[model samples]
Target: MAFFPSLNLVARRLGMYRSGGKGAWLFLPTSSLARSRPGRLRPFHAAFSTSAGAQHSEEENIDHESSLGRAGISAFKRAVLARHSTKAFDAKREIADETLAAILALTLRCPTSFNVQPYTVTIVQSEDMKQKLAACMLGPNSARVLQAPVTAVFAADLDPVQLVPRVQSLERRKRGLPEAYLATLPFSVAFLAGKGHLAHAFKDLFTTAMSPLQPMPSVSTLEAWSYKNTAIAASWYMLSCSVHGLDTCPMEGFDGRRIMHELHIPASRYAIPLVVSTGFAMPLPSSSPERNEEAKKSPRFPPEAVVFKDQYGHAYKGISQL
Candidate 1:
């Protein structure tokens, strides 16, 4: 797949080019970075308040935990830089159950819209499901999905809906924000209810239930939330994979409607927004380049373009009076 280089991102990360609307990258001498101790330069966003988080696209709070230990940083840097999406997987390669578990465990810790925790992880490693998934995604993707060692499909249950009111009431109390107001938060955090509400509540009332309707509606919204929530989780998992010399590909171009049906999930109970295909890479052809030149230049926008002062449109890089 052609990596659509977002000019804005390129300009910000690399500081070399600023075509389109991208910000300019300045030459920060190696001396300057060396003089500045690591971890001391607070990520600009980290220092900004919600007053700022609200204005700019609120990037996630990356509370990094060094699971890699003393040399973990170097290893992590290696993993991230090397990691890339692979639509094609070698059929001979098998994804160990333990490795898959390790990856999913990382995702399970993914932050939810609320503490309500509304997503489910479905690892479709079954040959049956893989075939069905492949069929669903259509020709090439199906072949890839079937050949791939593991396909992790993310779903959302209506379980969070039940707690919405309660969560909302608490949000209002805790932060003086309205109940269910988190929907306005910068990311895809969501809440939904379980199916038990109407069934169980009617019996308790001891009245012949007049309504036989399902309690929840709008499966798309649920799936969308799960996609965002799990995408973040999957991002961390991919990073973990990179460090361990494993490979991962986050793919959504597949046919999700077919996957939901093939997986035997009810229309109401489950919603799959995205599928992440992960496995080992194929052997490089003898003609393959010694260096992945395009990959090497994972261009980014200049620091000035992304970082700003106290307000929007003001570029602030910690001014110091000499």
Candidate 2:
């Protein structure tokens, strides 16, 4: 699930220090980065082009060999580089069941906090069901939903704390760990949930007091935590679809309540975070300016602009020297 095998390569190229001994973190170079110069860094702009349309200039094209110095691109890199938020899909094109299964299998491997896997994906393929779901969508998204062959509703469990013990116990049992390790599961869930207002107040007080001494996660409702985890899975799902030669459009402009009701998803138990429409992208017509414009990739800020090193405001040394 480690997306970037290049990280360890980068670490070694930068002569990063690692603890030496058994059971210690090892920073080993990969075959891909073996040909890359130790001190040399590729220009961020030259590394990869964000422009997706065919109309981009030669300079705007991605220099994969120069950037990665690898004979072939990794599947992870290929997926990340190729993925774009598709606005229109070819209604005639449908994803095969096997391909869809593979995409879902990869998506499910995405990591979650404490391995709770708090999200649920509802796949809608029926024409009638797609129309019903599209009715809940707002703006142009409704049209997009109707166009795609499949739409996945990503929902987060409203009461994810209740799932913690069940998931943890199952995981422990599978690993042949002692059952006694889960003795504090109930107490832990209660502490995390902070059920009543009084309990919430106490929990907030404890977090506030402890934060000054050590780092603590910002105090938030269980719903917020669930959404955070669910978003991760949704992102992975999009990339997985892209890897399978499919395109996805993630839509947040939907009536969550209506979607839940239509799908028979209990609002008390789950909340819709977002929905993604997946299918082959519609081919652009030569004379269609709107389609061509939509195909163009939006500009992105350079790594040096957004990424920081040891402290905020300090540029990351590696990217800055590129």
Candidate 3:
């Protein structure tokens, strides 16, 4: 079976478990999928499975290579510091096809709960589609949507339970997990799904109604989990774009229902978290005082204010302490 190198690394890093000389599975509750292009949904199960039974120790593993090099890390930090919710873009500039591919590949490497990978990116590349998306966004954001070379709608799958079983099994087998370990997954999933009424209903229908013998997994707050996981992927996408000399603006001020309709996403199956506009950035105005202020860097809280050590209230000290 052909596995994505990133997926393999993620599977390893995220606790790929094995027992009884079986398969190795990356244990995550969420199922993430990759879409090479718009309107195409491919199952990641095959791509995530492997025939090799070789077990890897966390320290000695060579498959776990960093996608971001020293230069990439520097670029990432600069991007994080420099990135803004850009409202203006160089509409004349277009992202190269290879660059976009590289960005998506990196984006899929983001971790998810249970390794379920439960989201899809709908790429809007054409001007007509961008205009349609703009109609659903706020007046101010509409221009940015249209001006960017691409607008990616990050949507979460409401019914990812359907895809979990195959992925779980394949990933587990690849990791050489035993049947005893695999048996516990059903109950774990059911317990998670049980947390939320909507999630419980959707997941229970499959685990119980479809197969009364199995345990169900539902989340207490399904939408929250979905949004959070998808956002991680979105962040990765934006940073990856930054590393490729591109820009992005993550927008939430849009009509979700209208976006669903425009994008042909069925309301029953998917939920839109936000739309991200991607392209080259236009230079901030230098002469205008108001525009200059807009160009000023935003302040951030110090590390001591946000970083905790052992306990919640304990502030983390400098690296010298380590």
Candidate 4:
């Protein structure tokens, strides 16, 4: 019997028992895939069929090895980080759907303030939608977004922290996290998430469906809040992709109002945060030795220079100096 690397990866790496904790199958490593170029292999799954009589510890041993082989447990992450965005993508070939989905899944898992993940993402696949987004692409990015196989928009809800009380209301119930955890933090989360919603939806939700007597924050505050929060989420998405191996172009040069009008997204309900162009890079002049020699060899601060001891001015005189 033949097995695909993806399936083999899952089969061998997973616990035979379906509910065996981490043994459970989770498809699409979004962060990893987002970092991947279009043609690059997105090994989302690995197959490992367990021995019917194998001991549990042996299974653990296998998992340990699997971790080590994750992208070869590579030491080249820094090199990947130094890579710049490509202005061109080979759009003739399409990025696999699963791969794209995986990329998005990472956004879902991305850290949010108090874990209040409040971002709306739209994937532009149709030619017309891509056309609509073209103006959103900046200078060199404009050409790339038009030619790329897929363009994704990352939009966030502001004041997402407003949703914290509700989140705590729900989260505290699960695993019994005390409702007090919310207060211990410097800021309120439910307030943020709720604020995000208000920024994005309150005006419309009130005008179209409210009691007609409800008070609300001014339109400008809500708008500003939504734009601010969504941009943060979008930035996180970009950095996460950057560390993994994907190239992302964060575009702000387009007409947000036109995008809202064309996409049918109510201006009151959502604001366009960023149009991210994803795929393999088309090799930059910067990648060449002549262009990058200086940047690549740029000096890095000594560990001691940055790592300050307990006090701000306390210099580390020696080891255990931490």
Candidate 5:
């Protein structure tokens, strides 16, 4: 899936040029990343807020037990740089189940809006199923779909408000929210969900009506929220694939309506966001010796163009200048 909803936004904000086309993203080989380069900007010295009890709660500290360990930082750097869209995959090369599980397990730790993880991933690997899915795609992706070892369809739960009780309870305890407000959370969620009462409830419930109580938590459109959260999780999964020496191609151009119907996905509950094709890439043809070598690097905006200071237009001086 395209991480950002708009390619034009990415181009305008970061000054990046998409490699193959609008949907295509190029991944570099891990060996190509320089060991000394910092992965990203360090805007603040503290990792989190130091205000009293401003600390991240145990539930929020998902990375505390990260298995990425000593090599985690470098591994992530290589993965981010190396992950690119692989237009072709070696159909013969299959990913081990264990490897896929590890990637999925780590990536699932990514945060969702209000911790309500409302995404569903369906993995299609059988040759018969792959062929069926390929038929659903419109462009060159048809060939790419069949060639890949596995295709994962990511969907979002349409009724994410159902998860509110579980999420709010955990978050309330972790974040030190008042226990008195817990009883009324479900009603507030319902009020916000109802279109007729939404505007009044959104304004009154969080403000004047609840003035004696604390502020009501934010509850926006579930469809939009689910899409954003699912995309983030999918991105993390793709990066994890790169870290494990796997390649992935995220495709939003597929016929999602066909997929949902053909696959017997519950249309009422889930909404398909995108499909991802993942596996090892095929070896370069002997006729094109330089293609493999050239794959290591893709066009990217320079650091100075993308990074900013306190303001949007103010470009940050890169470490090279500092």
Candidate 6:
């Protein structure tokens, strides 16, 4: 009898075998089976499997190597090093609409809890509107806003009822989730946006009690949650601007109430987290050597000072070397 690997053995090793009842066998190319010798099983390689399996294996190898490669690391490091908060922007320079749109597109990919993006970015481009927004800013920030050709206001939607369920349903549908799963979105939203302080307090008590047994995320008010998620998106927006060769000044000195009124955004529904001005940076004068040196030496706390090994206050081994 010609020797062949058992179907079970082939399935365990190759994971490309077809499934069926009693007489089913691993499908190897006829040439391979024919080449098998009596009383000696031939070893199988992934190259000998189905084309789909070979292609899948190739893709997995490529993805694994690329993820660990230095090219991606160097690019990300460059972006981080290039990013800085510009004190002044060139008034004559303007970002192309397409570039701005691309930056916003990447910014929208920032992660949010439960994938509910509870934020809106209002773009201010008109000179009249920019002037009005500048009036809403305080001191030096007001000048920066007016100097930049474009400004974006990042607002967190305090009321989840306005956006949560709709966004959840759309995202779920794209993933081809079952209707039964999608049906739970409204209830989930209601739980996230608890009915009142009394309800939230009760829920928090229950989760806090359960914390010793398993992991539980602390429940926070909707306003707090919205601000947390919106801030993440705003951070991503600044990085995206840097990657596009645009300088940004993130200002929190704006009058939120006045901005809401000027933009016709209802204060009850949304809260401004940050306002960012984006444009080409003003060129530094050659005469200001001392100022240029200060700009180059942007200070930061050492990693050892901020990062712990496994617990708070524990020294991270070899971090000082880094």
lDDT of 1 at 8: 39
Off by over 4 Å in 2: 1-73, 178-180, 193-201, 287-295, 317-322
* Model 4, C-alpha of 86: deviation from truth (Å): 2.2
Q: Who is ahead in TM-score, 3 or 4?
A: 3
Q: Which residue pairs show backbone clashes in model 5?
A: 26-84, 27-83, 27-84, 28-82
Report the C-alpha lDDT of model 1 over 36-106, residue by residue, as the tens digit: 44333323212112232232322344435636575867766667678877747788988777777776676
Stretches of candidate 3 off by over 4 Å are 1-72, 172-176, 194-219, 288-296, 319-322
Q: What are the TM-scores, per candidate, against the unseen true structure?
A: 0.56, 0.72, 0.69, 0.52, 0.66, 0.74
Cα deviation in Å at residue 314, candidate 2? 0.9
**Best lDDT goes to which candidate?**
6
lDDT, candidate 5, at 213: 30
Kindly list the per-residue Cα lDDT of model 5 for residues 155-262, writing each as its tens digit: 988776787788667867776653423433443344334233465444343334323332333445656657888999899889989989999999988888889887
Model 5, which residues run further than 4 Å from truth? 1-70, 166-221, 286-296, 319-322
The model with the greatest TM-score is 6
After TM-score superposition, the amount by which residue 144's alpha carbon in candidate 4 deviates from its true location, in angstroms, is 1.9
Worst lDDT 10-window in candidate 3: 35-44
**Cα lDDT computed for each candidate against the true fold:** 0.54, 0.70, 0.67, 0.52, 0.66, 0.71
Counting clashing residue pairs in each candidate, in order, gives: 20, 0, 35, 35, 4, 0
Error of 6 at 316 (Å): 2.4
Worst 10 residues of 5 by lDDT: 41-50
Off by over 4 Å in 4: 1-83, 159-176, 179-187, 190-236, 239-245, 283-322
TM-score computed on alpha carbons, candidate 6 = 0.74
